[model samples]
Target: MSERVLMKGNEALAEAAISAGCKCFFGYPITPQTEISAYLSKRLPKVGGVFLQAESEIAAINMVYGCAGTGTRCMTSSSSPGISLKSEGLSYIAGADLPCVVINVQRGGPGLGGIQPSQADYWQATRALGHGDFHVIVLAPSTVQEMADLVTRAFDLADEYRMPVMLLADGLLGQMMEPVVFKKREENGKSFDKSWAANGHGGKRKHNIINSLYLEATELEEKIHERFKRYDEIKAKHTMAESYMTDDADVIIAAYGSTARLARTAAEKARSLGIKAGVFRPITLYPFPVNELREATKTAKRVLVCEMSMGQMVDDVRLALECKIPVDFFGRTGGIIPKPEEILEKLKGV
Candidate 1:
């Protein structure tokens, strides 16, 4: 049986991680995401788990790396600036192929920008997160319920692929309150497979290696190619997205995260004014549901990429549409959220 309860998105993420059998959490408190750390600080202890408030974001990510090395489900979270500090550890974890979850409740910034909700880190989260030829499975949640659900799914995907997963949320989704129905705890006595884990090998195994370094160049190239192949498989299987009224629309809106919520509202308003509009929300940011967008653009004349950043996702939309349709961009930066009225106006002009 499932029960529904009103919860903030940050609290929901922490609760869902615990419910998903995560036993370790290390994070630093930062604006718009502080509640996550605070909630875990109190809840993890009761569940026989460990939650540590590290001195800095760098320390927290490294702590997660260490816990994940033991084959335990571990996580760390931060906002934009803090995520930047953890980039080195992120690259290391990706290189080592350690399974872990990293949540980024995005805020505006190239520097220490404002704390208001912004999806300006779309490029950072999807592409340039760390200096390496690596990709992290990125999930975007548009609602508090999806925030919880996606956190659990992120952990599952991380463990399944032995790679890092990122829950790419924004300040609006993090702070909003909504009703969520959580899954019942797994009671089949299941557990993570730890054959590759560095948890002190007994007499059965002679040695264990967790480092990402391969001294031979050919070996490293082979490993990298294998990783990319795995990513391709994930892209085929895990591209999640939602389409609303896109079947017969002239203009379609492509958005994700919290911006999708606003776009949905805007699309509804546009429809009321007798404008044919639809919305496509990418639940997975990295794989990006490009095929879906490509199909939608087959009939649609224009696609307006609505985001909280300055046209980052627009690039993806253009690539997906393959210049078959015109892709326009509407966005606001520096922690400013685009309003539904503004989006409607942009649609009117289209």
Candidate 2:
């Protein structure tokens, strides 16, 4: 077992990515997540990896696109607005089926809202991360330990499915400190096949093309259909959630990332007050863990969703439960973090 080390969340995440065998990082400086780049800037070189701070988020994501086409394990990090700037490149990478990780250490935003934690990007990350008929796998980490742990998972998922994967965190997790135990990079001799990569073939095989553009409408549609099949497979196999004390509860609280931690605390408080409140946390945002959520909340009379945004994930919760049970929402937006007492109050009403 590795010794536990106290580290900031963003730095821990960066180091974990290195331990996951990420060979290159291309990113721009953005608050909350800048430490990821800063940490890697120094550490990646020490590990014989490459790190480059691009001129802009757009350039950074494109650089990721270029590197990923060569079948390298690579990633980028940015805050909300910076992620928006990289959206176009994100679409391009998805269309080409390049595997890479993108980390969003979120902050409040429509545009430069503030430098505090926010879950306002739920829609952007899962539904419309970029303009496309595509989806990236999104993982939400609720703890500093998860912030470190999810990096390797993100990279593995990216490689497994041949698509972009996102580690969706926020300022709270990014800036917080916690003790974490990082596993050594697994050195299994086996590697993912990269026969389709655009890396030089040493004149031994035909050139591999990595382009998203399909001039023919039918061809594009065919590619999209194929991709959707992969999405369906991922959804069926990879959806994940944590159901806490939900076996017998009248009220179920739905939350994710940093907000889920608070919800769990509130659930405990509710239990102390003779109220059966369970917390259901979705770990995979894109797959959304709908079936697991339905099972978790099956005994509930009502459901409450708490978030740092104005009811983005609540809609999903409502849909997941199919609206047979009443779903309520409580939120604090514009970079405000809600207290467990607030969630407890909401639970009391439920």
Looking at candidate 1, the ten consecutive residues that score lowest on lDDT are 185-194
Task: Report the C-alpha lDDT of model 1 over 188-211, residue by residue, as the tens digit.
Answer: 224556678888877788666788
Show model 2 residue runs off by greater than 4 Å.
Answer: 188-190
Residue-pair clashes, model 2: 0
Model 2 TM: 0.98
Estimate candidate 1's RMSD in Å: 1.3
Q: What is the lDDT of residue 317 in candidate 1?
A: 87
Model 1 spans > 4 angstroms off: 185-192
lDDT of 2 by residue, 1-350 (tens): 39998999999999888888899999989888899999999999999999999999999999999999999999999999999999999999999999999999999998988999999999999999898799999999999899988888888888888999999999999999999998766684237888889999899999999999999999999999999999999999999899999999999999999999999999999999999999999999998999999999889999999999998988888888888999999999999999999999988986
Using TM-score as the measure, the top candidate is 2
